[model samples]
Target: MEYIASEALINARASTVWEVITDAGNLTVWESGITAIDGELRNGGTIRIKTADAGGRTLRLRVQQMPGEVMTWTSRLPLGLLKRTRTFTLSLQAGLTHLTVKEEVSGPLAAFLGNTRPDTSQHLNEYVHAVTNRAELLDRAS
Candidate 1:
């Protein structure tokens, strides 16, 4: 399991954060690594996020939970013969929010990511920075 996580406090309200986070069609508004996404927004719904990487691989993303200040999703993708599970969790705090993403690679290729993926903390840090930029949207309107 190659686990990583991040936490951030935006200079905005939870309601504002919730709106930006739940807007399924607008991931490019924050996540820098996502180029585009097309799909539905609901429990068990699927979505495809065109990542920063070229060719825009349509990742297998599904909402693990929905309805409330917290939402989660699990993304499955193959790294060679191994399958990877990436879990994203979001939680609201006092006028702030917390977001975390964890990745677990298993099967025959498990060692591939667990051994080769360098700078795990750097990825999480970038994610937090990208998502926290949502504060700009809230600030602009307010």
Candidate 2:
């Protein structure tokens, strides 16, 4: 399996962070990479994600929700040949929220695409930063 994971300590409550990150309607308010997404964000829902440059892709993802702690989404890539899983986990540590985001690719073609595809760490980092910023702002307003 090929994966990318990022961890950071965000100065915000886990619940607040979770709420901000999972709300698809508010995604554009924080996330820079996504142009738009349609469909409800929940278990067994289909979502259409439009990126800024790469056009768009639709994913029928199976969501695993663990409120305030973790949320995971898994889906099969086009042709059902490659599997992709994305996860976000939060933990309370020393009065701060420890946040981790990870995405993994697996399948027979995983190694090939993993090597050819550009590094996704940068995209993940952007997501984390945006989430952190939004969470902080929301926390301060409350």
Candidate 3:
């Protein structure tokens, strides 16, 4: 199991950040590392996400769940010789929103990730950047 968690202090309120984060189509705006997000995004709905990291490696991900505050996905990529289960959790604290990303992968291919996950680690930063970026975007939108 591998976990990467990042928190950010947004000038905007948590609800504002949550609205931006929940806008599935804006993944590229805030999370530049992700190439695309597709499918019906709703509670218990399955979706497919494509990620092209800074290294320009395109990876495919299948989302498992996307209920409020909790999003789970599965990657065919191996992590410690097992299929990886990734989860993104969002919480509101004070005026800021906290996001935690968790992953567990087991498979021979998972070895590709090794002990370090560049994409997942990058995602931690993305979460933080996304919230703050959205806050500013929203400010301008208003």
Candidate 4:
């Protein structure tokens, strides 16, 4: 499996950060890489996200699991040759929220596409930064 992940400690409540991260309608406000998102973000729901970095490919992801502090979304490439799962986890540590976003790709095509895939590491970092920055900004405003 090929993996890309990013994490950061945000000085905010876990619930506060979770609210901002899970709200599909507000994703583009903080995540500059994402141009738009359609559909809801709940267990069993489906969401389609359009991103700038991924050559504007609309990622249709399903909400595999969504609990209070963690959410998992899964997507499959054409012909089911490749599958990708992205997870977001949050926890409170020492009065700060530890946020993590991780994506794993697996299947027959994973090895072939691993090297040619877009800048996943950079995108992951941007995701983390956006979430943390938004959380901190909202925390201060409240």
Candidate 5:
């Protein structure tokens, strides 16, 4: 399996961070490379995402979440040939919120897709930064 992860300490409450992340409409504002999200982010929901990196292609994913604690989005190829899972975790540390975002790809076809997969390290970092900024800004406004 191959994975990319980023972590940040956000100057906001866990609830604020979770609210920012779970709102699909707000994703385009903070999630780097994502242009649009077509669907809600909720358990058993499906969303189609348009990204700058996909050349106008849309990626569909299934959503599963534990409210403010964790959220996972899974995208899979037919017959389990390839699967990608992106998880977001939020926790309170002292007076700040600790956020971790990770994406893992695995399956029988993972080796094949590895060559085609674009490096997402920078994207993940930008996402974390944007989220932290947005959440902190909102936290202050409240």
Candidate 6:
């Protein structure tokens, strides 16, 4: 399996951070490289995402959420050749929100496709910073 993860301590409540992450319409504002999202981010729902990294390919993901705590997006290749699951977890700590985003890639072809997978460490850091900045801004405004 391949894993990429990022975390941040934002000066915002968990609820506020959750709202920011779950708002699909404004996702592109904070999520770097994501060009568009075409569906709601509710549990048991599916959303199609267009990203600059994919070269115009749209990624379809299944959404799973645990309200203000966790949200996970899963995508799979045909015949279970590869599967990727990205999870966002939020927790309250010392009146602040602790956010963690993790992505795990696993399947029979994982080893074979290692070279083809993009290195997302930098992207993950950017994502964490973006979320923290946006959540803190909203927290201050409210």
Considering every candidate listed, which one attains the maximal TM-score? 5
Off by over 4 Å in 1: 77-83, 92-95, 114-121
lDDT of 2 by residue, 1-142 (tens): 8889988888988888988877989886666477787776675666666665444554456777777788887878678679988899999999999999999889877877745665578888888888888888899899
RMSD (Cα, Å) of model 2: 2.0
The TM-score of candidate 1 is: 0.71
Candidate 3 Cα errors over 4 Å, as ranges: 54-67, 76-81, 107-112, 115-119, 139-141
Q: Rate residue 141 of model 4 by lDDT.
A: 90
lDDT of each: 0.63, 0.80, 0.62, 0.86, 0.90, 0.89
Residue-by-residue lDDT tens digits, candidate 3, 1-142: 4445666656665556656655678766665455677765555556666666436554445655444477676656334355767676767777566666666666666656675566666665765676678676785677
lDDT of 4 at 4: 83
Better of 2 and 5 by TM-score: 5
List model 6 lDDT by residue over 29-134, tens digit each. 7655589999999999999998766768899999999999999999999999999999999988887889999999999988896667666777778878988989
Looking at candidate 6, the ten consecutive residues that score lowest on lDDT are 113-122
Estimate, for each residue in 1-142, the C-alpha lDDT of model 4 and write its tens digit: 8888999999987878988887887888776478989998888999998998778688899995556588998999788799999899988888899988999999899989956888988988988998899989998899
Candidate maximizing lDDT: 5
Per-residue alpha-carbon lDDT of model 5 for 58-130, expressed as tens digits?
9999999999999999999999899999999998898899999999999999988755766677888888998
Between candidates 2 and 3, which one is better according to TM-score? Answer: 2
Model 1: lDDT of residue 99: 63
Quote the lDDT for 112 in model 3: 64
Worst 10 residues of 3 by lDDT: 52-61
Candidate ranking under lDDT, highest first, comes to 5, 6, 4, 2, 1, 3
lDDT of 1: 0.63
Residue 23, model 5: lDDT of: 85
